[model samples]
Target: MDGAIWASAYGCQGKAVASSAFGRPSGELQARADSPTPAGIRQRSGAEMIMGQGAVPIIVGGEVVGACGVGGGPSEDAEACAAG
Candidate 1:
């Protein structure tokens, strides 16, 4: 990919440090942290995880494989792009 594209995508630019780590979509995680469900509260995960919709975790065989982050558009659009 070209530098321009890389820079535009959140994680593609060697920026989404949690690329090596694995977990739910950052938005969900962030939401839980911000205002957890009635049954339970959550602790802060880390800085690498962000509070947005562009990140999509790549899972295989029930295991986290990698991730994709598309950041040049709205939340739904970017999320769809990454999922594809």
Candidate 2:
């Protein structure tokens, strides 16, 4: 769940990075789109695999203390588990 841990550290949802990576296959994901390349899918999977998923930051007093990663079924299912 490295992706999930990274998510907490970055203070962003796991899906955000994945989506960005998919939406943009060339250059920085934050850059131009409408010209997605095969590299985009690779980047997305790599980031997700390396960063982790189905995880949520454990915050206390407005500070992140830890994170929880859940994986069993689909990413959505995992995310739902983490959310609860």
Candidate 3:
């Protein structure tokens, strides 16, 4: 995958893993929305969610330690490679 896609995939997976750990599916969005800001400033919404099917969280001792994302091939092939 290209660097941009790789980075985006990693970021998305990280956020998802974090949300799963916290048991809040919208934790990232909620936090971004709830942040205090200047009156004239408006927080942006509708952020694109780029999820790479090949990415999976690495769990250790019942906690998510890290993640791995693979791209550049068919989604299922990438996922299978990552799974193995």
> Which is the leading candidate under lDDT?
1
C-alpha RMSD of each candidate structure in angstroms = 5.4, 10.4, 8.5
* Tens digit of per-residue lDDT, candidate 1, span 1-84: 322454465443222333325355544444444444411322234334444666677788988877776665565666667678
* Regions more than 4 Å wrong, model 1: 1-7, 11-22, 33-46
Model 3 lDDT, full chain set: 0.44
Q: Ranking by TM-score, best first?
A: 1, 3, 2
In candidate 3, the residue pairs with backbone N, CA or C atoms under 3 Å apart (3 or more residues apart, or in different chains) clash, namely: none
| Residue-wise C-alpha lDDT for candidate 3, range 9-40, written one tens digit per residue | 55455444433433333223344433454111
> Which whole-number lDDT from 0 to 100 does residue 31 have in model 3?
40
Model 2 per-residue lDDT tens digits across residues 10-30 = 423433443333432111332
Q: How close is candidate 3 to the true structure, as a TM-score?
A: 0.44
After the best TM-score superposition of candidate 1, give how far the Cα of residue 16 lies from its true spot, in angstroms.
Answer: 5.6
Candidate 2, 36: how far from true, in Å?
18
To one decimal, what is the Cα RMSD in angstroms of model 3 from the true structure?
A: 8.5
